[model samples]
Target: MASDGESPVRLAAETWESLFRAQVAVMRKLQAGPAFKKVALNEYDVLFTLSRCPSGWLRLNELNDHVLLSQSSLSRLVERLEKRGLVARMAAPEDGRGVLLKLTDAGAELQKDIGREHVRDISGLLGPALTAAEQKELRRLTEKLRNSVGARH
Candidate 1:
């Protein structure tokens, strides 16, 4: 939902509606599964973010900043992953007090396996709908949105 005009937001109603509706439509197309047999969508999101991290590890607060879930929910999710041997919880080496989250070897392998299927699914879904140029433009717009939202990874 859009907040009140307290932020530096500026978009015509039609433009916002198009953007939002298109996003919802695409998400719906990607929602079905067998694509992510090893992990649910939200869980895969966490693993995907970690896959891009330099060390396969992130501080919990940093992870919270990047993920769509709330910090508390993420904490519980992390616990579940840990219990399943997909994630490891350890003391942050940079600082002793905070917790650090790392994907296990098993988790990384699972992520790769699921990610391959997911990418193929995306290609199959989007290829006929969007031309190559349109796909590039879509990436540009999404990147702009990411940058607007504090440029978190």
Candidate 2:
């Protein structure tokens, strides 16, 4: 609700629908590529998250915040990666009760390999639809939304 006499801003119906449709369409295009042949998109999501961590590791709960999967599902995914030597799991040093997930050397290499192709795929799909300036603006707008959502927690 707006405070005092101020009014809250809202997206127009058409604008909202366009944004939603664009996102779904882009995601479909990105997920359809061969880059995810070796590892499923969900699995790649975990590996990619781990790759971004400076420590190359994160506690399970921490990882859960970054990925969309449920804890049980994430645990099972980690197991699959572990079985393939793509990730390693160990007890968190601070508290043995917590499990820490770390991307292995092989995992990092794999993420980097697939990530290169993924970047290319993204550019190829969006290159014609958005110009350099529009892409930058889109990124800025999306990040703003993401930060706003993250701020709630």
Candidate 3:
């Protein structure tokens, strides 16, 4: 039954469609860039997090949380990065049982390159569509939405 003549079915369908379209648009924009070709976004995120870490190292668990990846998935990603000589894992000095992930010089360089490419891609996609003030407003709204959703958890 509809409340106050409101069409719940139509509303829900429209919401889903909007979300799907937005995701596809954003993904298409990101995928058109050289960064996507050079490294999968998730891998780049992991590398960027490590690159920003103090001493270029983060505990395995800390890195996993930052990337929002499952332990198995992060382990697989780390393994691949290690094989590429972009990251290395070592036992934590304070706790030999804990592992620490650190970026290699190659990883650092890759992160820098990808960061630049990402900036260029984003600028190309939205630079003309929005003025600086509009961009600032969009960032503000995005943060508000993020915080609202985060509060629900």
Candidate 4:
């Protein structure tokens, strides 16, 4: 037995949980795909961030913030990427103590390839379930949620 007020609260919580689970499932499946088999997700994230930056470079702290990784984890990942020739670290010109990470040409090419595959995967998985209008609505609603949550922090 439940009151009418409780119904809306239960419904909202259920909806949020379902949406979160679905998102996680989709991401897991995407990561398991062939295109991602060779690269860790964090590595891809770091590469993508550098690709978006001017000169394909960003400060070590900025990369950590953008990728939400611990400084030690980021340093290890950068070391691996450097070994693979996918990224390089250089001392910042203004501050010799500060370091910047830049994506190599190979990293840029890999990002482009993996990004295309990711887009294709998303389109294939979700495009049929959502009409164009619904997709737009979802984007708007998600952005609103992001903004509201960001404002709180």
CA lDDT of every candidate: 0.84, 0.89, 0.86, 0.88
User: Per-residue alpha-carbon lDDT of model 1 for 6-98, expressed as tens digits?
Assistant: 433444566778988987887666667577666788898888888888977789999998888998999999899889988888998778989
lDDT of candidate 3 at residue 66, scale 0 to 100: 80
Positional deviation of 6 in candidate 1, in angstroms?
22
Model 3 Cα RMSD, Å?
3.4
Question: Model 2: which ten-residue window has the lowest total lDDT?
Answer: 4-13
- Model 2, range 1-153, lDDT digits (tens) per residue? 355544444334555688899988988888889898898888999999999989777999999988889999999999999999999999988898999988989999999999999999999988998999999999999898789888998
- Of the two candidates 1 and 3, the one with more favorable lDDT, higher being better, is 3
lDDT of 4 at 127: 91
Candidates, ranked, lDDT: 2, 4, 3, 1
What TM-score, computed on C-alpha atoms, does each candidate reach?
0.84, 0.88, 0.79, 0.86
Q: Give Cα distance to truth, residue 76, candidate 3, Å.
A: 0.2
lDDT of 4 by residue, 1-153 (tens): 246556777887887999899899988988888768768877889988999997667999888878868999999999999999999899999999899889888988998899888789889888998999999999999999889988998
Q: Best candidate, lDDT-wise?
A: 2
Ranking by TM-score: 2, 4, 1, 3
Model 4 gets an lDDT of 0.88
lDDT of 3 by residue, 72-97 (tens): 99999999999999998999999989
Model 3 segments more than 4 A misplaced? 1-20, 151-153
